[model samples]
Target: MSDVRTKYKDIIEFYKTKNIAVLMGGLSSEREVSIRSGENVYNALVNLGFKVTKMDVDANIARKLIKDNIDVAVIMLHGKYGEDGVIQGVLELLGIPYTGCDVLTSAIGMNKIITKELLKAKGIPVADYVVLDPSNPDKSFNDILSLGLPVVLKPVDEGSSVGVEIIKEEDQLKGKLRNYLRRHPNSFAEKAIIGTEITIGVIGDQKNITILPIMELRPKKEFYDYEAKYTKGMTDFVIPAEISKEQEEKVIEYTKIAFKTLNCRGVVRFDAIISKDDGLPYFLEVNTIPGMTETSDIPAMAKAAGMSFEEVVLKLLEYVKW
Candidate 1:
């Protein structure tokens, strides 16, 4: 993979004569994070000698693209309209090539319940979960008790752990569900896996995907929520995760399978839980358009794998095909 450095020479030459656009700052809940990522990618491309345009995404995005004559779009937006394939669909109609997964894969990967079901169908290990609708708040607590106590209640479509709650006691389940419904309107509950949390960052084509070192997330809070994830020093990231070689190998293998299962391209990240009792890793969810913030997991894993941010960004650009 060291050849990636030399391989980028051709990409650099191609970019020297092409106009690239870094799309960011959508109206999603993650708009602020998107802006940060776009700025980073924009500056990195400029430093690498590519003619770049930093476009804050708006409803008039198509007109903006035509006006700027964007040859390639480097998507830096996260969550909702950005990561959920809406923007990718628009780009497809405009006949523009962009970075990251295609529309179908992006949409599937962004939805937790759908991604879990797909993985489970492939015989991959995933925590047992039940989907819920806020309109019908008449579910029995006994039904949830079937999954056991200490369940995780979260929004089905939200990212950044916006409405996730760790219900430790049975009495608090209904209240938490009500609160989550107030925000999400449609959410679900999953049996919480009491074990180590790990994330795998993958990049490349379908046939040659590379999984970087696994990262372990130890949050000060009970779980890795939005604050613990985005805030500095709230969580400890252990590279190569302190797991057995066999366990590590299993995670890498499953990570690749999960990536392919979703037909993901460019770069993607998967989060999983390693059960302490059995040492088995269970798939949690996949992020098609993973965050690119400096402190994000993908970047951290890439650095551990000896790849610089510039190298990852440049490699991603090369992988983007219409």
Candidate 2:
């Protein structure tokens, strides 16, 4: 076995002939983004001389994988069935080694409410939040009021900020509810942590976790909404966020805590907010399957750590446990 610490291109030679399945595109709100991510993974793997197949996943994903005789699955799916552990569970049953966390970790990571509560119980700082089941949309409005105005309402299980909303005024709450609930019946509201929004990307195995440079997101808009996240120039990324050494250390520490407490595996990104009030980093959410496109934050963070796009892809595949 070669040292996993060796350069990526060299390590990749070991798996050149393995049948790889780049799983992307599914019945999720983020289907298009997943397709792009899968394309990145596909191109990178092919460029590295791997026997790879790009599978635009659908309802019959298992059948497709069976037909392909895939030796490993590089998951690039986002949202619902893709990110919520449904596909991970299927892959587990099929005995297919896939990227990102396992089924249980994927389930906890995708559910915003559960992730927040679990983190809070472990003394990991998280923004105060309330979960409202769609059947009882109005139930948690008052509870959410404790967070005050400018609260963020998001789907409990959705990713890529598909149905995230910022309610600055009381009048905006109803409209947000109507629109958000339509997409995701179960909604969660959290007090907006007013401060610098930083995202930390971590890579390495379960034993040794390596933190990439912290990324500070400066969106042209009020917050890092979906547009700011995907649109090329909508947000400016500050690599190795300009902050005091203490603040950067805090961000890395808390993020690593979330990674371990969540029982995460492979590479994962932890989004956090450094509150302007006390300058404390508050846990936002975990992206188990972080993006792989050129503009994706994880790759940018990896590049800051001196890893190329090909190297990042190879490292992700190398870190796969099952």
Candidate 3:
């Protein structure tokens, strides 16, 4: 923590003269979570003595940014327009630097299908899945059936497991999938990898990245859904996951490859599952703007690595480049 403070001391001092906005509470399914994250970050920046303001993103975000003269944005917005490159493109055009992955990366990272395809191309182990086009229910149902029962249905662009469903039987598949497609036209069906749920946190740029201690999530629910993620006492987090050292090494290696493959920047979280059958890790998806709330995974991993929440926020701020 001391080392990070020393390294970013100049950057911190430079930001003192700038108007930094903690962008949050965007129009997304994860708006409430984003607001919580933004509040924590806003408070940290205030306690650290930086000129910061809280910005709840809306259709008028551009005008608001201009009005406030925000020079930098610590984006705490998650899902939809916030994390799927829309806001990033706006920030890029506005010429205001912000934290986290760039425009293209955010777009790719938001779509599960595209993200998995890219990771698979890079030889990163990812679960087998098929794209579901809302235009064709027949093809979508058949493709999902081919993966066998007990598959996970995921919306391509949603975060926090929003609109995600688990189909265990064939009869339940058609109705649930059709209903899901009605809501989320762009989605995919993945062969559920039943195993230990793990998440890896990475910080810094491609050249100098830090993979924090791996975490294993024991969710009280059937899987780590939205409720399990944000609800208190719903999940037990284990740091330096109970996997073998070799397994840990493989996960970390895959994490590095995925980070660079996706062109991720600042802080990101990679979710994976260690298959109960083979005990090997299969990369799932990446969170470009990971939550900074009290129960967030990134903060827990950083704490395990001996970094305070404030120091992690500073480290994230240090990597802010347009």
Candidate 4:
């Protein structure tokens, strides 16, 4: 722990005049969530005595960033263009360091199909899934049905559980699937596993990775949907998830592999399902820029690991690279 503190000591001290920026509130379905996250982060930085600017980002973000002369940016945005490498690419070109993955990793991380394919290719366990195109949803039905009933449908390049649904009946599959696809343009289906849903928060980059305590999400609804996520008391979370040591170890192991394989930086949240049958952890997806909201799982896990919310925020800054 002393070594960890010493490693980040210089970075923390450098924030004295660093001209920090908290970029949030983009044009995504998760705009409101982003605003909430942004405010939380902005306040935290102020409380820590950092010179920070809070940005309700827009298409003219480049102009605003140039006007402010942002030294380093902390991304609190979610969904679509915000977390999907657009902002990251812009930051790269501007020669500014930002929290989270590089442009390549950010782009790949946003697309569910691409992320799953890469993870599976690396011998990581992922749930059975089939991609569906909005223009041609007819042919993918059979492939999806093969995965069995009660499948999970999610938008291809979205976050915060936006546009995610479950098809419990075969008859309702085609129409509902079409509507979701039409709305999202690129959505996919995965075989739903009935078991514990856990999210692991991994911090740092490469060799110095630190895995926070595992958080088990139990939504009042069937799954952790957008409503359950943002709405207060809509979900129940169990810290250090009530699993055997072996299961815990497997989750951590897979998390490390997923983080490194995706070339992630800063803090990331890896969501998974511990199968009820074989008790194996199936990698769902990775959030390259995990939320820093008041109720976000990453902060909760950090508290469990004996780190305050302010400390977690500072830790993310330590991993930023231009």
Q: Which RMSD values do the candidates have, in order?
A: 1.8, 2.5, 1.5, 2.2
Poorest 10 consecutive residues by lDDT, candidate 3:
1-10
Taken over the whole model, the C-alpha lDDT of each candidate is: 0.86, 0.83, 0.90, 0.86
lDDT of 1 by residue, 164-187 (tens): 888889778867666667677767
CA deviation > 4 Å runs, candidate 3? 1-7
Tell how far residue 308 is off in model 3, in angstroms: 0.7
RMSD score of candidate 3 (Å): 1.5
Kindly give the stretch of ten consecutive residues in candidate 4 with the minimal lDDT sum. 1-10
TM-score of candidate 3 versus the correct structure, residues matched by position: 0.96
Q: lDDT (0-100) at residue 141 of candidate 3?
A: 94
lDDT of 4 by residue, 44-77 (tens): 8887778999997788999989999889999988
Residue-level lDDT tens digits of model 2 in 72-176 = 899999887888899999999999988888899899988888899888887888988777666665766666676788899888888777888888887778656
- In angstroms, give how far residue 242 of model 1 lies from its true place: 0.5
How does model 1 fare in lDDT? 0.86
Whole-model alpha-carbon lDDT for candidate 3: 0.90
Query: Highest lDDT: which candidate?
Result: 3
Instruction: Order the candidate numbers by lDDT, best to worst.
Output: 3, 4, 1, 2
